[model samples]
Target: MERAQPLPSYLVHRYQGWKATGYADNQSWYRRLAELGQHPRAMVISCCDSRVHVTSIFGADQGEFFIHRNIANLVPPFAPDGDYHGTSAAIEYAVTALKVAHLIVLGHSSCGGVKGFHERCLGRAPELAEKTSFVGRWIDLLKPGYERLGGNDADIDSATLEKEAVKVSLENLLTFPFVQEAVDQDKLTLHGVWNDIGEGGLEYYDAKSKAFRPV
Candidate 1:
């Protein structure tokens, strides 16, 4: 087996700097968190995009939110076939074990995953349409969102599809019996949001109006 390489010099230096500053300043708080374990109020499912800074967006401190990031912030409908499911595993843990009060699906503008899905649907990205491509299969979960846009790639808008993908994820979340039960009993709430990366603006889905509103 190949040995794992050490972190890059730049990352190592940054880690040292953080340990001396951020960690030093909040050593006690860190210790308390270690002792108490996490008791986060919400679980955020967001994109793996580097620019989408989850903690910075909410001014969240360590251990405040149980966050899961994937290619397009998608959640597949419940399928318990004993197969490997990373995202579903995270959701199950958050809902059943952590008992998070809220589950939020956060989408962002200019998401590469969303763009790739759009291109794939339009047959512009043949690589993503291949069955063996992991990313292709992952983004295929967004097919429902694509279909919602009339399934006519020629007339589609990527921006609107991004928000629709968020809504689709929220819908898929309820497919889990645990999540459905929690929502039905008022034990957990689900939220969908889209962030405009360029403008630093956030809009949340309003179920009542069936639209996204500025937050």
Candidate 2:
């Protein structure tokens, strides 16, 4: 076997230029970040997909959002056990240590993870049985949403499933002790967001409208 090649010429040149210009400021940003620590006012739970970048989509600056990214941005109910619990640990730190006031679960269009979940449930992709070993276990948190669909799984569109998964994650967030406590004390708020990749639009869950509206 052979190792992969280095980056292309254009990318290398562009990266070098960005490194030169982006870092030429009043001070080195990395040092400032280390000194200031992350004091983000809000925590955003988003997918690990490269296309759904939280900072780029929200136009957020450094230290603006304490972010946690995982497959499908799913937050499982609080459970203390042998589970790796990467997302839960980040949530604990954000809520208990950072004490962020707002927690946003951002879902985007055409999420591959959610599509994988759908396929696993529908038995279309058996190879997913091995690949989804961990992801399938995590996505079980959305079992209620699957039940809520209450129709032919084939007829359930991927977009609809993706949106429902966000709602499921929001519901699961309440299961966390720290998050529940924060919400009960009126110290934390939960938001569900849908980001449209094609149109560059953001739709937030509107309680008054009972639908997702432009944000």
Candidate 3:
């Protein structure tokens, strides 16, 4: 089958420019990274959204972060179910092997996974029920939060659901033995961050303030 769309002229020009200058600008850094291996100071768990590029957001170069991306940046409670635990396994390696000092769960505005959970819980979209797929199974992790919201169909707002989902994932992170041990032993600090793309603002979860505040 043919591709759905052709490359835009502007993007095609930019891609050509990148191909010409990228090697000169990036090759040395990549070579150094290869020689040094990764010694990232932080491990960021972010959503796998093309718009939410973690490195660009943080102004980071290659090898600056040990990164893992998943739907909604959700971290499920650790379980040995003989299934693929991609996110959990990455976290384990980042903590135990790389020994990163910080763990950041990066949530963002207009998250599809969070929105899907809200709709699923509220039963707003019955068609979603027919699509039994990975996203559906993944969002099931947020069921407790959905129940806690009292099943009031009116309370299923996207913003509220997204914020609550961040908290849920933060709590779920503690369920992992490696994460808990790291936090208890003062080896790592856990943080939840919400990026508002519309406002170009970042809100961080403050334990003392008990709310997400601008950073």
**Clashes per model (N, Cα, C within 3 A):** 0, 0, 0
lDDT of 1 by residue, 111-148 (tens): 99989998887789999999899999999999887887
Q: Tens digits of per-residue lDDT for model 2 on 65-130?
A: 999998887888888998688999999999999999999999999988888877877887666567
RMSD to the true structure for each prediction, in A, is 1.0, 2.9, 3.2
Q: Per-residue CA lDDT of candidate 3, range 1-215, in tens?
A: 57678889999999889867985688777788889888999999998878898887889877789999999888899897988999889988999999999999998999998888777666885655566667888888878877777655455767667777788888998988888999999999999999887887888999897788889
Candidate 3 — which pairs collide? none
TM-score of each: 0.97, 0.87, 0.87
lDDT of each: 0.94, 0.85, 0.85
Which prediction has the highest TM-score against the true structure? 1
List of clashing residue pairs for candidate 1 = none
Compared with the true structure, model 1 gives a TM-score of: 0.97
